[model samples]
Target: MNFNPVEILGLIAAVFTTSAFLPQVYKTWRSRSAKNLSLTMYLVFFTGVMMWMVYGFLIDSLAVILANIVTGFLTLILIYFKIRYKD
Candidate 1:
């Protein structure tokens, strides 16, 4: 397989930044709690990720688009549970 350093680097960066919220999500789901999780921040982040996904589509970057898609869905799930189980 031919590997392009730049593409690999971009995917790595995307994975890191996009998965940054995973810990919080796991903690919330595991503990069944959403306290201290900022709804506003997640809402804003969701919007941002949605936009990023759109931009990625426009630019024809499947990696970026798919990463953002998954991130966005997870964020939405967290956000939904957060609201449903507010402290």
Candidate 2:
């Protein structure tokens, strides 16, 4: 688990970006409303994230893989909420 400076920077960036969705997920879950969320956008974003994950695996990048895995999970939750809380 030896990370170079660049990888460390990447992990930092990944932490920020991946955690960014927490508030939205919490809000959606607590409020039980996703009428304002765009399903199409999330679907597209999820697809992109999946691609990034694949790229990460191919490149053997830990930061990208970890970040996308968490992001993908959060995105899935948002998608589920969007469908379940559809108004």
Candidate 3:
């Protein structure tokens, strides 16, 4: 696949945005504590991510599609943890 500079930048952006959630996922997985996490925020965020993924698909954007798919799952994981760990 021939990638232009813009695509490269998009991939880089995707990497940053997707990886940003890793720390929280790791922490939540290890500590099983999501006390400070906001369920509303995640719900909104996940919905937005899903919408982005759909938009990506419609536009045939690899970076947007791939990134949002990964990010969407990560957000879902957070949501799962939030609900599972909530007291």
Q: Name the candidate that leads on TM-score.
A: 2
The model with the greater TM-score, 1 or 3, is: 3
Per-prediction backbone clash count? 0, 0, 0
- lDDT tens readout by residue for model 1, 11-85: 787788768868877889888889888899999999999999999888777667777988898899899889888
Q: What number of backbone clashes does candidate 1 have, counting pairs of residues 3 or more apart or in separate chains?
A: 0
**TM-scores across all candidates?**
0.82, 0.95, 0.92
Of the pair 1 and 3, which is ahead by lDDT? 3
Report lDDT (CA) for all predictions. 0.83, 0.95, 0.92
The alpha-carbon lDDT assigned to residue 29 of candidate 2 equals 99
RMSD of each candidate? Answer: 2.5, 1.1, 1.3
Best to worst by TM-score, what's the order? Answer: 2, 3, 1
Q: For model 3, state the Cα shift of residue 31 in Å.
A: 1.7
Q: Model 3, range 1-87, lDDT digits (tens) per residue?
A: 338898888889999999999999999989989999999999999999999999988887889998999999999999999999985
Point to the candidate with the largest lDDT: 2
Q: Per-residue lDDT for 3-27 in model 2, tens only?
A: 9998899899999999999999999
